[model samples]
Target: MSKSELDEIINRSLELRKKYHELELTHHGSHWSVEEDALAFLTDAGLVGRNIMSQQERWPKAHSASELEHKIGESIWWLIVLADRSGMDVKAALENFLSKTEKLLDQ
Candidate 1:
């Protein structure tokens, strides 16, 4: 898909997330500055990776595949939120990441 196409989707997803979690965010004082939000995002990212290991180890008592999926989405949302908080363009960042990875792989 085109960069703008992905951007449109990210925009809508962010809007919907804010609408759905507005009250929860306000209750938890989640309007953190860029650095704080980025750190929080990193924590969520860690959960995503931890959940992957849990799944591999068949440790579903606490972490299931569903939890893994949820954490993955949450991690992605964290990236979007952190980028937005920093006034960075999520689409551009994604494109740059893909380019860098492709180059590294000699694609």
Candidate 2:
């Protein structure tokens, strides 16, 4: 997807949260809470662990491959929103980290 499409997805998620609040009368009633965020991370970690277990089992395929991708995408979206809430620019932070890593590797 293009940058514009990604932006639209982010905007749509924001709108969905707004609608959720309208119906629930509470902030994050239908959105991600800290516990939910931790659970998401744990879920993704479990997927990764399962993938490792599959490798150990000598399986030729991964279980929940598509779901794993979706989870990863969701994690990224959550990170982006969290960064925005924390007043940080995700793109800038990524660029800075990459640059710093390159410099450290060169030393």
Evaluated with TM-score, which candidate comes out highest? 1
Which prediction has the highest lDDT against the true structure? Answer: 1
lDDT tens digits, residue span 40-83, model 1: 77888888888888877844546677888988887787788777
In candidate 2, what are the lDDT values of residues 15-95, reduced to their tens digit? Answer: 754564476557545655656555765776676666656656755665666665676666666666655656777667777
Error of 2 at 46 (Å): 4.5
Clashes of 1: 0
Clashing pairs in 1: none
The regions of model 2 sitting more than 4 angstroms off are: 1-39, 42-62
